[model samples]
Target: MASPAGQFHPWRHIITFLVITAALYALVFFTPGSTAPKLGIDLQGGTRVTLLAKTTNGTTPSRDSMNLARDIMERRVNGSGVAGAQVQIDGSNQLVITVPGQNNLEGLTRSAQLNIRPVVARWANPAFVAQAPVTTAPSTTGPAASPSATATGTSGAASTAPSSPATATAQNEATTPATGSSTVTTASSGQGLRGEAAALLPKAASTTDASTTTTASSPSSPPPTTPATATPTGTTGTAATPTAPATVEPPASVFPAGSNPGVLTQPAGSDEAAFTTWETAAKAYANGGGPTCAQIEYFQGLDVPDKPLLACDQNGQFVYLLAQTLIPGTQISDATSGFDTQGGHGWIINVTFKADGFKTWSSYTTAHYDRTGGTNPPPDSMTAFTLDSQVLSAPVINEPITTPGTQVSGSFTQQSAKSLADSLKFGALPLAFDRQESQQVSAELGFQYLKAGLIAGGIGLLLVVVYCLVYYRLLGLITILSLFLSGGLVYAVMVLLGRWIGLSLDMAGIAGLIIAIGITADSFVVYFERIKDEVREGRTFRSSVPRGWKRAKRTILSADAVSFLSAAILYLLAVGDVKGFAFTLGLSTILDLVVVFLVTHPLVALTSKADLFSHPVWSGLGNVARAGQEHRAVAARLQSKEA
Candidate 1:
C-alpha cells in the first residue's frame, strides 16, 4: 500500500542534512584562522614544560590548591595572547604546560602577584652612581636586588589620565572601558585590539631621558618650603631622604571608601613593627650606611603588603621606598593592552577595577591630587605597580581619577604591554611552581605519530566496511553512505569547534574516532536485524522498514546513552590525554544518534519502496523475504479451504 501523504518526508531530512553539511564545509575552507582543526602539542611541534608545585612549608600541595593552580595557569596561557596552548594538571602536584610552534614558556609559572603601592621616596640607584661597587665585598655591598622599578611613574597613565603625545590627536575620542566579558578594542580607533593584544609589534626604546628626571646624585631644585635633607647622595648607601614623612600618619591612613573617618591605618593592618622594619631598611640605606640598593634582596618577602618594600627599578636607575599596598592587584577585574594612537602613547594597559577597588582608587587619587605641588606631584603622590617583587611603574597621580579603570602607560612595545596586561588580567596563582622538566617536541616526531594514527583509523574503517558489504550485500551500500555522511559532519564539527573553543585533536582523540566507527556500525546492525525480524513475521519489506525503526531506535538510544555517560564520567575523572579521548568519544556518540535517525533510517525507508532494491536476494534478506512469501501463501490457501 502507498504511504499516507505527508506522514514522513525522507527527502526533507536528507536535504536538511545536506544543507547543514554544505554550510559547515564552506566555513571550514573559507573562514580565516579556521581552515583546519587545531592539532594538540603531541601532534604539532612544541615545547612541554612540567612544573612541580612547591609549598612554603615543604609539604605536598593539596588537591584543591593544585586544581586552582591549574585553572590560573590555563588563564595565564590564554592571557599570554597565544593560541593552541594547553595546561593540564598531572597527579596532584604537577602541571604540564604545552605551547604549540616555537613559542617560549619562560616566566609562565611565576606567582604573578601584582601590588599597587604608594611611593614613599625615590632617588637615583646607588649602583649606577658608584661604578666601583662591583669590586666591593659581598658583605660590604648592599643587597643585589633584582631589577624591579621603572623610573617613570605609572608606565603610561592612570586608566583615566590624559593621553600622552602619541594619542594627542585622538584625544577627542572617548576612551571606553573594556570589561572582562567584552572584546578588547582600541579606545581611539574603535578597532579590535589585534595588533595591540594578539601579536607583538615593534620594540620601543628602553631608556628615558635623564635630564627631566631626578637622580640620587642630582636633586631637582626644591621649592622654598622643601626640606633641606632632600638631596641625592652619591653611590654610597647614604642616599638622602625626602623631607616629607615616610609613613602615612594614622587617623588619615588610606582607608576603604565610605569608611568612618575615625578609622585609621590601611585595611592591610600595617603595624608599628612593620613600619620600624621599613624605617630600619630605609635609614640603613640612607644615613646609617647600611646595605646599598644593590645589596637589598627585593625578591625576599617584598610581596608582604603590610610592610614597606625597598626595591630598584627595572633599569637599576632608581631605588624606591614604597608604602603598603593601597590597591591590591586582586581588586582588578580586567586588564587589556592597546595602543593609544591619539594620545601618542606607544602602548598602554587599561585596568578595570572591581566595585570596592574602584571606590578605593578614586579616594586614593583624590587625596593625592589634593597634595600636588602646583603642576608637579611630589614623590608621595606616586603609586608603584609591581608584579611579583618587581616594580613595573611608579606613575604620579596627575589628577583625581574618579573613573572605574586606569591605564599603565610607558615606553612599551606591543609584546611587553600584552604581557603585562595578560598577567594583570589572570591574577596570581595560589602556589609557586618550579620547573622540573622541559623538552622540545620535533615536527618530524609529531608527523610520525600523526601518520601512525591515520593508518590505524583507516585500517579500522576498512575492516568495518568490508564486514558490512559481505553480510548485508546491496543493503550495505546504505551503511556506507551513512558512515560517509557521519564522518563528514564530524570532521566539519571538529574544525568549527577548534576555531571557537580551542579544542585540539591528539593521538588519543584519533583513537576515539576510530572507536566511533564500531559504534556507528553497531547501530546499523541493530536496525537491520529488527527489519529482518519483521520480514520473518510475514510483513512486506515496505511495511517492515518503519516498524523495525520504531523498535530498534529505543535499543540504539539506550546503548548510545550508556556510551555517552561513560565518556562523560571519564572526562571528569581523568586528566591530560585521557580527557581528550573522553571528549572526542562523547562528541562522536552524539553525532551517531543524529546520523542514525535523520540519515540512516530515512535512506532505508526510501530504498524499501523501490522494486529493484527490495528484491529478496538484492536486499540481502533472501531467506527472510522468501519465508514471509511462503507464510502468506499458506494463509490464503487455508482461507480458500474454509470457504
Candidate 2:
C-alpha cells in the first residue's frame, strides 16, 4: 500500500468529484423525464386501494393473470388522467393501486366489460302497457312493411318501438314502486336490474302492422301467438300471401337461458334451473307484462356474459331480453366522447374496435339488416352495449357497419359520456377484484407533513453546520462543502431514478435523507478528529492529514457498510412506505462513501497543504499543535546531546 504521505493526489481526487458532479447535473438537465424527483402518494395526497383477486370458479389466480390485471389496471388509471397512479402486485393474488389526488374510485376499479349483444325482446312495465288495440300485416315474402307503431299507455305516454335499435337514453318514463301501483318519474337512473322470480303472468303484447307479436313463458316452451285485433295491411309481393292466416304459428324466440341468474348468490356454482325460473318470469313480462317496477330493481345485478339476461333500463320502466355477448370489450381499441354536431345528438361516446371486432360487428349488423336475404329482420335486431350487467346503449343496426367507428348516443352529459369513454378505452380486467382496503390522504395534511419534515431536517442540518464551524473553525468549511456535494449527488440520482424506475420520495424517505445528513457529517467529524489526534501526537498538520484519512477512511467505510446492510435488510422485510425509508437510507449511505472518498478527503488534504491554513489558529489545531512543537524541540535537543 502507498504510504499516507505519498498518496497525496488531492487535485486528482477533487477533479474526479467535479467531473462526476458535472456529469450528474448534465444528465439532470439533458435527460428526458428527469425533471424532478417524484413525490409519493402520501406526500402528495392521494388514494391508495388494495384489491384481492377473485375468480368465478373460486380458485387462486395465477401469477400471469395477476400481472396482466395489474398492467391493465395501471393503464386504466393513467388513461383516466389520474397523474402519478401506480399499480403494483403485492402478492400472488393481491394488487395495490395508488392514485395521486383522485377520489373517484368507481371508474378506476370497475370490471368495465363493455360487450355488444343483440336485444332479443323488449318488455314495458305491465302497469304501463298500452290498452290501445294493435294491428299487424300478414306474413309475406317481401322486403316491405308498414311504419313503426306507437303504444299509448294509461299514463298517456307513448314509447315508439322503432325498427332501429333504441339508444340507451330513452325518454324519462315513470317507474312504479316495488310494492305498490303508485308510479314516480325518474329522470336519471342507472341501468336496469336482473332477478330470480319464477312466476309467469299474462303480459300484454302489442306490435305495429309491420311486426309480429309472440310470447313464450319459458326457455323450452314455444312462443304463443295472439289473434290480431285489426285487419292486416295489404302489400304487393312476388307470391301472394294467404288471406286466412289465423291458424299460422308465431316464430320461435331467439334467446336461450345458458346460465342461472341466481348463480350470483351461490358460492359453489351456477344453477341452470334458477336461470330457467328467472327466464320464465321474464318471458311472462316479455310476452304479456306482469313484473312490477319493484321486482325489476330488486334483482338487477347479474354478471353472466355467456348467457341471455333479463335486464331493465335505469328507470326500471322497461325490461329487455338480451342475448349472449356478440363482441367482447377487449376488441375495442379506443374510445372518445364528443358532441354530435350532425344529428344534433347530445354528448356521445364513439368506440373504435380492433380488426376482428370490426369484422364480427359488421357481420352481425348485416345479418340483422331488414333488407338482408329479402327476409324480415330478426325480432331482436337491436344491439346493446353493456358494461357488466348494465345496458349502456342499445341501438338498432340501421345499416351495416363494415368500418371502425360505432357511436353510443343517449341522454348523456359531457361528464357521463367522457366517463364511459374512459372506461371503455382501457378494455376489461381478466380477473375480478374486490377492494380489500382503501386509504386516502388529503393535500393539506400531506403538505403539513412535508413541511414538518423539512423544518426538522433544516434544524438538524443547521445545528450540524453551526457545530462544525464552532469547533473545527476553518476546517468546517470542508464539511459544509461535502454535505452540499453529497446532497447534490443524491438529488440528481433521485430525479433519474424517478424517471427510470418510478421511485417516489415519500415522507419516510425524507426522514431517511435527514438522517443521512448526520451520517455524512459523522464521516467528516471522524476524519477531522483523527487529524487532530495525530497533531496532538507530535505530527505536523500536513502529514497528519494523509495519515488521518488513511486511518479514518476504514472506519467510515465500516460504519457506512453497517448502515447500508441494515437498510437493505429493512427494505427486503418491510412493505409500503417503510420500504421507501429503507431504500433512501441505503442509497444515501452509498453516496456518503463516494463523497467521503472523493470530495471530503481531497478537499481536507488540499486545505492542510495550504500555507495559510498550516498555522495553528487558522487550521483550528491551535494549542494542540503548539504543544506538540514544543515537545519535538525538547526531544531533538536531548537526542543531539546524547549523540
**Candidate with best TM-score:** 1
Measured with C-alpha atoms, the lDDT of residue 243 in candidate 2 is 22
What lDDT does candidate 1 reach at residue 199? 5
lDDT of 2 by residue, 1-643 (tens): 7568655687898899889888988888986664678787777777888888877556899988888888778766654221356688997889988775545576455677888777666655443334333443333222222223222222222222332222222222211112111111111221121111111122323321111111121333322222232221342221112122112221213222232333321112235555455455446546653433344333333356666665554434445666667988889898887876654445767777889988997787677743422122344556666675556545444445555666665567666666677767866777777678888866534778888998998999999999999888888888888888898899999988765445777788899999999999998999999998899888888999888988998999899999999999998786666777888999999999999998888888787879877888877898888787888899999999999
lDDT of each residue in 386-455, candidate 1, tens digit only:
7665565655454566567665655566766777677778878888777798988765348888999999
Give me the displacement of residue 203 in model 1, in angstroms. Answer: 28
List TM-scores for all candidates, in order: 0.56, 0.45
lDDT of each: 0.62, 0.61
Worst 10 residues of 2 by lDDT: 190-199
lDDT score at residue 317, model 1, on the 0-100 scale = 45
Count clashing residue pairs in model 2.
10
